[model samples]
Each structure stands twice: as structure tokens, then as C-alpha cells.
Target: MHPSRALRYALTLLLLPLGNALAAQVQVAVASNFTAPMREIAGRFERDTGHQARLAFGATGKFYAQIRNGAPFEVLLSADDTTPGRLEQEGAAIPGSRFTYAVGRLVLWSPTAGLVQDGPDLLRKGDFRHLAMANPKTAPYGAAALATLEHLGLVDTLSGRLVQGENIAQTHQFVASGNAQLGFIALSQVAKDGRIATGSGWVVPTDIHPAIRQEAVLLTKGQDNPAAKALLDYLAQPQIRALIQSYGYGLE
Candidate 1:
């Protein structure tokens, strides 16, 4: 081989590890309802940008408290737009760095097939032993569920059967495990390819409740972190947005 070609080959080999060396790891706080889609996005983010996102999933309100208390999370993907906006106002997050990534859809779901047909009528009948939902004070989906019940004027009628979960994932588990006959959950929890992939579900109409606008923001700690910015940018990419849509969320 020519001397110049050999030197260039040696330089290329030496630089191969540089990209990995420069890659950063960011800690991300993610809302429970976004679990599945966020996991997919994180994986794609690492592969495409060589930056690893370490995700922690839970209720958005709880995450807000954690962030204010100096949690190590460098980014936040909240279940509601309000939390992010509040964080920005409190100076916990970078102003103007937040944007709605998904508009969530609520669903009445049951592990038993056909059990969720005609959701409103079923709820009005009030025959079920238990109906699970997230903690309305913390999870936006839970608030939407409450709004839905109020819209149907069944809150008082069904008050005796309500079961609350700490987060939407637990709410889903309550129904999936037969502890509750059915539950209100994020559609993404049981959906794939824009359809419910599980036993049965009724997509709650948006007109009945407040829209769950999910927002992503760069936390104050991540202001100088490349991986944090990269992850947010990755989520905004056309392909990632399409993937989010496939999981039953409407894009902003």
C-alpha cells in the first residue's frame, strides 16, 4: 500500500472511537403514559445520535415536584402541558425550550374482549364492581377520566366503584389483572399501528374532556448538555413523530 494511504487508514481507525467517547448520556424524566412510545424513541435516539437517554417513568405531577427538589433529570417529558409550562415559569426548566410533542387520547379499556363496547352506556349502567383510574391530582389522564365521567353525569352515581392508581401504568394493571373490570388509560398503552392492540377499548371523544397535550422540555440542568438537546431534537424528527402517531397519539 502507498505510504499516504496507510497513514490515512491509521487516522481513520484512531478516530472511530472518538464519536463514542464524545457521546453523552442524559437522564430523562418521562410520564408514565408515554412509556412505550418513549422507549422506542430513546432507542432510536441512541442509535441515530450516539447519545443515551436514561429514562425514569412516573406521574407528571410527581416529576414536577422531583424536578423542583433538584432531581438529577436533565429533561422532562410531561403528560400535561401545564406541568412543563409551570416548570418554565418557576425557572426549573429553560423558557422557550418546551413544546407539545403529543396530544394524548384517553380510552376505556378492558382485558376482556367486548367488555368495553358502548363505553358510555356501560358506565351509566354501573354494573361493574370496580373502575380504575390514575390519581386525578397527578395524572392528566386521570383528570380527563374524571372530566369524562362528569360529562356523562355519572360521577356521583359511580362514586362507590372507583379505584385509583398512582399512575396510568398501575391503572392499566388493575384492569389487566382483573382487579377492575375496566379502566381509563392512555390509548397508547394498549394501541399499536393506530388501533387498540389489546382485548378491547373505546377511544374517548375529545369533545367530552380536555385535550391531554403532552409536552417535552429541557430542564435547567440540561441547558448545556448536548445529549439532552439531541434527544429533544430527535423526538421532533419526522420519522419519530410518525412512530409516535402509530402508537395512537396525535402529533402537535
Candidate 2:
């Protein structure tokens, strides 16, 4: 009944096959912007290997805070390269385990017809009453949106009309629900098989916005986990990379 006794029994369980199977399941924290593709990848990883991958999606900012606060995530797939690198530098992530998983793209999208037919030109025309974007302070997609607007020299001009979502999913929701009329969301969200739809979108040229290289890192806490390491390695294999690319990500 004592705490030490309970821990001893728990440790003893690891010697059993059932305990090993459960212990080998990898827990992952993924960025909301990459939700769709990650689902595909995680499923494949689980099927090919007996090890399961449990996934959580949210703003990278929120996930990073959770990981730092000691959330039990074994792997982190972030929307930006910097966060994983920072975690490594801070000794939160496993050293030498960080790598770019995908390059993301920002899209100015509308569910309605003709509202955003020709990209930035529609923004200048300003027929829509509202626009949605993620919090630039948090979502990398939001940061890309702000950068694109600035490149078009429309930031101050459209500042009053912006409705900022907490993350990329909410931004997509606002536009899809027609609450905001238009929104800047991840290209992957609106894609069927990694290509954009025709209702109208501007695949903000990679040249304009900052390069969005989404990175992944196996945390130092999970270094000894074979499942976590295998999953990360699976992501880089030619076959898996092809699958990811088909989901609209530029794999590195």
C-alpha cells in the first residue's frame, strides 16, 4: 500500500510482455497546421510497427508550453523549425534528433465563390466584410499571412477588418462557416490530396513569405523509446516522404 511499494510493482510490470507493449506506445504532440498529414503518417506508423502513436494537435506555442511544463509527449512535430531547436538547446528535446519534416504553405481561402478568385487582388478590392487569420503571435500560418499582407503593402489598410483565430484550425473554421467570409489558413487544410481547391485560393508564393519548414524532434525524455525513434525515422523514408508530399507537404 506504500508509494514505494507501488512504484516497485509498476517497475516490475515492465518485465512482462504486455507491459512492454504498452510502454512502447509513443505519445506525440503535433502542430494543428499539419493535422491532416500527421493523421495519415501516424496511422501508417502504427500499422507497420506494433507500436501505437497517440497524437495531440494544437498551436505550437501551446504545445511547447506543455512540453516545458512536463507534459508526457514523446515526440513533437512543430509548425516551425525554431521551436524544436530551442527545445534542444534548452535540453528539453533530444540532442541531434531534430529535423525538418515538411515545408508548409499559407493560403488565402474562401468557401464562397469569386470572393478570392485572384489572390492578393481580391484583398485590394476589399469586397469581403471580414477576414480570418490565426494569431500571428502564435501560429506560424498567421505569421505567414501577416508577412504576405505586408509584402502586398496591405497590413495597415486591412488591419481593422482582421479577425484573428487562436490557431490555424479556428481560422479555417471562421471562413468555412462563413462567419468571416475569408481567411488565411494552411494549404493542407483545404486540400483533398495535397492540391488546392478551385473555389478560389492564392497559394502565397513561397518566395513572398518566410519559408515555413516544419520540424520534428524526439524529446530527450523519450530518447530511450524505440517506438518514438522508429516513428521519426519512418517519416524520412522515401515511401513515407512520398505519402507526406501527396498530402501537400514539401518533405525535407
Candidate 3:
């Protein structure tokens, strides 16, 4: 072989392993409320680091059960801090590997104009046939919505009219598809560029419910995974945090 050709072949062999190392994939279980921002962040992560993220978006409660049952998630981005804490205690996640990444806001949203005004008053009147919300037992956003209703003294009155979705994403769908007149959804899902992208919504007062402190954790399956750790670190970057904030989430 010519000396130049031999040198080029040697370099290619040496670089192959490094390229493979940079292309690691991390499997992440993310809350449905974080779907949009996570997608954007994952794209940026892949572009910037050459590490890919495989995301599964759903209810945190469901993810918890799956993780406990040996699901193959390397990381979890929960809609509430409680779930990650519980996972850490249960040994489903790495101890002390969790941190609050974002604080989420809840909103009473309606796709139709004039259908929702003075959010609490609309509930008090109980004029709407179907009011959508996520399954409070499975979704933190649902729990927050329920807490807000309880705070407003409208839970019992509105119970009969409530329509439950499996997750926050579905809750938004229920309202958007006209299956329900209005619903409580994560601000991140409906807002873009710091404003509601469509329909009308009222940002629920924080005092009405517990703060939705969203957290991210390294699952036990990811303890030794460099890609997983890198993704977590990337999420904490100032630029990434700003991107998350622009999607209607507050930084912790």
C-alpha cells in the first residue's frame, strides 16, 4: 500500500471508536407536559453533543410504575419533584441524582373564544357540560388542577361535569377536540414565545395549589451511562434553561 493511503486507513480506524463513543443514546422518560420543550432540547443536545435522546412522554405516575417494574429508561423528567424523590427512596433511581429543572404553571384553557372567562367563575356557574382534566391520580398537573378546584370550593360541584384524560397531553386534546369545553393544562403545552399560542387561558394563581416543581433524575439504569449524565448536565446549562423558560416554564 502507498504510504499516504496506509496513513489515511490508520487514521480512519483510530477515529471510528471515538465517533461511536460520541454517538451514545440515552433513553429518557419525560412527562407529557414537557413534550415540546424536551423535543427541542433533545434536538439541540444531539446537535451539540452528538448524543441522541430516546424519549417516552407520558404521565409521571405511569413512568414510576414502569421504572419500578424494570423498564429500560436511563433518565426521567417528572412533572413533580415528589415522584423522583420516591424513586430515589425506592432505589429505582440513583440516590442524590435528582434536581428541580423547571417549575410549571397551570392554566385554565379553552379553544373557543368567550367560552372561558374568569376561570373560577366559569366553574362556579357549572354551565359547561364537560370540563376536562388529567387523571389526578396519575398526573401531577391533574393533582394541581384538583387542588385548585378544591381551593376554589368547586370540586364537589364540578365533579359531575369532569372529564378525565390519561395524561396532561390528552387533557389538552380533550379541550382542543371539543370533547370538553375547557380544561386545566400545563402552560408549557399551550404557550409559545411566552404567550398563549391559541385560544384563551387564565394562568392559575400559584397560591391555589402546591407548586409544580418538575424534577429530573438519573435512573438506576443510567448510573454508569455517560450519555445520560451528559444529558442531565446539558439541561442545567443557562442557555437550555432559558429555552425551557421560553416555553412557559419557570426556572428553579
TM-score of every candidate relative to the true structure:
0.93, 0.89, 0.91
Best by lDDT: 1
The CA lDDT of each predicted structure is 0.89, 0.83, 0.88
lDDT of 3: 0.88
Q: What's the residue-level lDDT of 65 in candidate 1?
A: 91
Better of 2 and 3 by TM-score: 3
How many backbone clashes can be found in candidate 2? 1
What digit string (tens of lDDT, one per residue) describes model 3 on residues 1-252?
234434533443444457765467899999999999999999987777677899999999999999999999999999999999999998888987788899999999999877766888888888789999999999999999999999999888888999999999999999999999899999988898767888988899888899999999999999887678778877877788899999999886
Top-TM-score structure, candidate number: 1
Candidate 2 regions exceeding 4 Å error are 1-23
> Per-residue CA lDDT of candidate 1, range 210-229, in tens?
99999999999999887787
Better model by TM-score: candidate 1 vs candidate 3: 1
Full candidate order by TM-score, most accurate first = 1, 3, 2
Candidate 2 structure quality by residue, lDDT tens digits, 22-55: 4467889999988888898888766665567899
Clashing pairs in 2: 94-220
In every candidate, how many clashes are there?
0, 1, 0
Question: Candidate 2, which ten residues in sequence have the lowest lDDT sum?
Answer: 1-10
